[model samples]
Target: MSTVMVRPLLHLIPTVLIIAALGLSGCSTSKPLPRQTAPPAAVQTDPPAKSHPRTPAPKITGKPKTTISAAKQSVLVSERNRASCYRLQPGKTSTRMIKKHIPAKKAATAAHLAKKDATATTAKPMTTVTRMVTTTSRCQPQSLIYARCRTGIDTCKLGDTSPVQWFACAKNNSATTFEPVAGSVLVLDRNARRGMPTGHPVYVEEVLPSTDNIWQLRISHTNYDRKCHLDQDATVLFNSTEMTASFMTGPWAPWAKDLKALGFIVR
Candidate 1:
């Protein structure tokens, strides 16, 4: 065997130092360990929800109408039409239900029956109405009115409210009515002032007057609008009679009487 050589103490001292470092490695403070984090807990979540909602309506329609009922009809106790119980609404241009006219056949039958029923009837001529009455100055008779009369007649008295305008009677001067005749008293209607004063009444003793100078028959009129009695059997009148008797009367009589004495007649 070869002879083993031993290094010096200095070299042996370095070997021992290296062994000592390996032995002291457990005391290091810079080493890291494995992380121990808790596991993630069970995840909890909510389910989804809902929103809003909806609904619907109803119906109607058409035109209005007009009608007449039984309650609207008239019930007359004394009806002219015994057969027809009710009348409909009349047309604007038509007439209401009225008295029925006789048919032509019915009229002919009535005429025939009337002819058989006819008796001997007396026929007489219609004469003019003649009358006389006292009157005052308030009765001014208008002679200018065109009165209908015969050729020789002097006065016209037709007070009917027709085509013929007549003079009113003495008593009816203020009334709306009158008579038709010569010599009949005529009155001015309370409202009859056609050409004369109203409320006037006068006498028409003569329809025609006698002419002057010849004393013959002629168409002349003399109206006495006013009259005053002079005395018994004497009158102070305006016209006619060819006399104006004033037996010691007043001045008013003389004025009228003198005119009578002048041959001016009073109607």
Candidate 2:
């Protein structure tokens, strides 16, 4: 009886040992559970860009200022006046008078043809050919003056008188003075050598600043060249003491030395 019991107990002990060994092997071979960490901290990022406000440009209020020199101003004024004067047209009567005064062209002499004579040395007469040349009048000084100075002069009183006759009309109707002034009529005595057969009358456009005591005048006239052409802004020098004016620069400057200056006619 003791043997049988002891054998059974031994068999039971072996079975229990095998089960424990199998449990230990399974635990060692199997992988351990991974440690849990707080979810990766949310990645920090820069905030979205903000829109910027636009700045308004300043507004301009008025016209820009400009600086002009005195000489320039004078020139601008003279030019403006001259342009205004040019816009005026000569009256029909004045135009007709100027055209009437235009000199007629002389007839051309007959052409003489000489032929050889076998019998004697004499010239043979042949039919003559005649040619005539004609010229048209352009403009006259008085007409231009009347038109330009209509504002300052009485054209009706002046009528169609030539430049030479303007002195008396100016003296009677206008104030004659030695002091040269703008918008005045300058009267010069006749000088055949200077080609001023009908004296000369010019309109004073401006009285320039003078370095010397003498007055420097800017004048506008026509027909001084006898071509019936207009000239403007001609420089002239006036001597109050001698009461004379000389052309400083112009077509007449070469021939006109110191012509007698009657005076300036101001209305």
Candidate 3:
């Protein structure tokens, strides 16, 4: 609280010191003293926390349903839209078009007269029908076509089954034909029980020019078991017309070409 006053010399000295210090201060900003701002705290950002994409759901639609009835039953829809509706019916089987019976309009007087006339006529009794037996065409016995089937033996190295079909060399089973004609059908074999073709059917290829060559025929088809082209085996020469074939299988049965070279024509 006591008041003290500096000597004039002492005050003058301090004031000079302050003026010198201020004059020493630079006119420039002094590079803003390198601004000591602190960086943002370690945030723990985790790379923006990756977001996963969501899958889309499927859309649904609806429609009507239909079902069929049982065999004996049928589906039908009726409509009175038409002035006249006709019913469908079955007609004759042999015809290509359908036939129908329609009602006819007539005068009452005429209709009555017709009715009277119909009544005046006497009716005849109906008769019962009797069935007749059917007979199939028979081609066996009339010819020895069946006896001529090949015995698997080829005069030219053709393989043969254990026994043979009728051959010329057979002691008593010589091959022969009673029916010889171009139009007639002759089998390659004479075996009866084995006559049925497993699957293949050998048709008569042709009737050769030679009369004794009835068995020498070309087969339209090879035995199903016979190899390809062998089905086309033809009897170029025939000592017998009754050559028979087993189920279709192979070789021309392989020597089909060889058989052809040997003058056996394709059936």
Candidate 4:
């Protein structure tokens, strides 16, 4: 009984030993499962990148750049030319130097001349000129007797036949005085030099202010310049002491003289 049991056990042992040997051989020859030492620490390296072909750089084209020295030389030359125009003092620019060089008197004179020219160019006041007609005669033959027509007094009223005789006739008919009065007749006796062959009668228009021994009279008369021509508002000078009348201004001014004044006939 013991022997039979031993023989079966021995057969099972051989089978077990064979299986163990196969396991050991597999474990040894399997390359240790490629050293699963934590999967070789998971070798976390990235994949290599792919390379591309390189391209050539583009070339630049233009005018050449100016040198710094040449640029600086141009700026210096321009500054020198500008500086030559003015004699600049220390701490003064060209503008200040030019202002300082201008003379004050010349500036003032220029200003004065400009003002004078402006004044000269300005408009002036217009003057009106009156022209008198000297060639025409409008006086009537009877109106040539100036004192009689102006005063509306006839010779009959003055106790005379004509104006020439009125001065002497007025002594009896009207008042006769040496003093001049407006609306009175001033009589002058015959005087050849004054061109009075008979006598002259002037109507006194105004007795102006007297100066010392002279009295100014504004008189109106006819036939003084030309026959039957009336002269109005003529200036006459009278001497109170000499009792003479002279024309101050008129056509008769050239032949002016102190003519004998008979008197003024007042009516």
Candidate 5:
């Protein structure tokens, strides 16, 4: 070993020691490196966007067009058909003229009815009933032979219950006197010598108003024609005074000019 080699070696030792110390100091003073992370796994995110609801398109229908065409065609076809039937030749008659001249079909039913009416005409043809008339007699008095008195008593049980004498009926039944009622009886007690013995009775069939207060009474009776037979219904005037009178005068007495009309027996 040489002295020179020893000295060189010592110097190399010092340099190495200083370099190591410097390296250690740099390591302690220096900041640590930041840890790197994978970019936050690409967070799938989206920005808010406006939303719109879908609207259905309007539907178009072919109904109206099809119907209109069909109806128009039908009307045109009908007019064409009618024109064929109604057309008239230049020299011939029109359909209207032919129809006017055409004879009506035979009416067997009408002919039969006419024949029946003719056969019935032999036995007093039935008169046309202008107003309704009941076939049944309306009178049902409690105790009286006179038709008028009987009718008064029966028709109105509450009224005319008293058995008034035929002559005094007007005086006795004044309270019950009213307008003529259909099917009520009228008594004729005018004169005994005039062929109206005791009293003649007539039935009222209908009452027709002539004015506000005046009325016409249709009446029927037996022997009105002096032939001792039932007479057809005849109309006679009933004045306002007679409406309230106990007994009104009737025009259809056989022997007397005026017949007494007993008050209607109606409550």
Candidate 6:
């Protein structure tokens, strides 16, 4: 209704219409922009560690071999006092040395020979047997230094030159026994002799206790050494009753490997 109001309104309407058309055209033709880039962050890091290979254990070694010396071996040998090791027997002297000189036997005089013959012819007759009244005698036949029978002193008769004969004579005189005593006579058969025809008799000087019901003895005998010896080592085996001897030995004798005592004549 007024001219002034009417003019402003017309002008405002055209201006707004023109602005809105330009805005719509710009929006249809618009393009998107590129994306932005960013810098990287810091990271923690460690130096490389040293490396080593595994090792094996050391091997064990064995002990070295040893050898004995000649002088050391010689020191192990027994001395001369222990002669059994050297001779392999008892009551024997060493025979390793050779003699520089040997003494000669003296010749018999002509008169001495004739006188010996006359003494032999005039000698008293020997008794063949001796009566055995007592069971034991205190005599040692070897101490007499003669081969003849020693009558009642020894367990032998006049004609009993060999040990076998003497043993038989003793039995005939009622001296037969199965066991031994301090003064018993141990009789061995010919089989007990080493390559000898006659048997032997040894006098028991002592009896001693040994292990496991066995007994040890010290004996005296003649001709074992071709002479009389007071004592030697011997082992005896007794029966269950202990009244009879089953076996006997003189382990030190040279013929010990083959010889054994058969029985004993006890007093």
Q: How do the residues 129-193 of candidate 2 rate in per-residue lDDT, one tens digit apiece?
A: 44444445444344345434433556435566765566666667666777887767787887777
Q: How much is the lDDT of residue 102 in candidate 6?
A: 34
**lDDT values of the candidates?**
0.29, 0.63, 0.32, 0.63, 0.46, 0.47
Q: What is the TM-score of candidate 1?
A: 0.14
lDDT of 4 at 218: 82
Report the Cα lDDT for residue 175, model 1: 24
Lowest lDDT block of 10, candidate 3:
74-83
Top-down lDDT ranking: 4, 2, 6, 5, 3, 1
Selected candidate, larger TM-score, 2 vs 6: 2
What TM-score would each prediction reach against the true structure? 0.14, 0.50, 0.20, 0.44, 0.31, 0.34
Model 2: residue 263 alpha-carbon error in angstroms: 0.3
List the pairs of residues colliding in candidate 2: none
Query: In candidate 1, what are the lDDT values of residues 203-247, reduced to their tens digit?
Result: 233233333421211121222223221111122223234322221
Query: Which candidate should be chosen as best, given TM-score against the real structure?
Result: 2
Output the better candidate (1/5) by TM-score. 5
Error of 4 at 175 (Å): 1.8
lDDT value for model 6 = 0.47
Q: Candidate 6, TM-score vs. the true structure?
A: 0.34
Give me the runs in candidate 4 sitting further than 4 Å from their true place. Answer: 1-144, 155-160
CA error at residue 107 for candidate 5, angstroms: 79
Candidate 4, 1-267: lDDT as tens digits: 999889989879989999999999998988866686656456543322222222212212221244655544543443344223222122222221111222233233455556745665554334444443323333333322445655555544543354556666677676678888766778887787766766788777778878887889887666664345556678999887898889988766677679888878876
User: For candidate 5, lDDT tens digit of each residue in 109-160?
Assistant: 5555667446643433233323333343322321123333323343323343
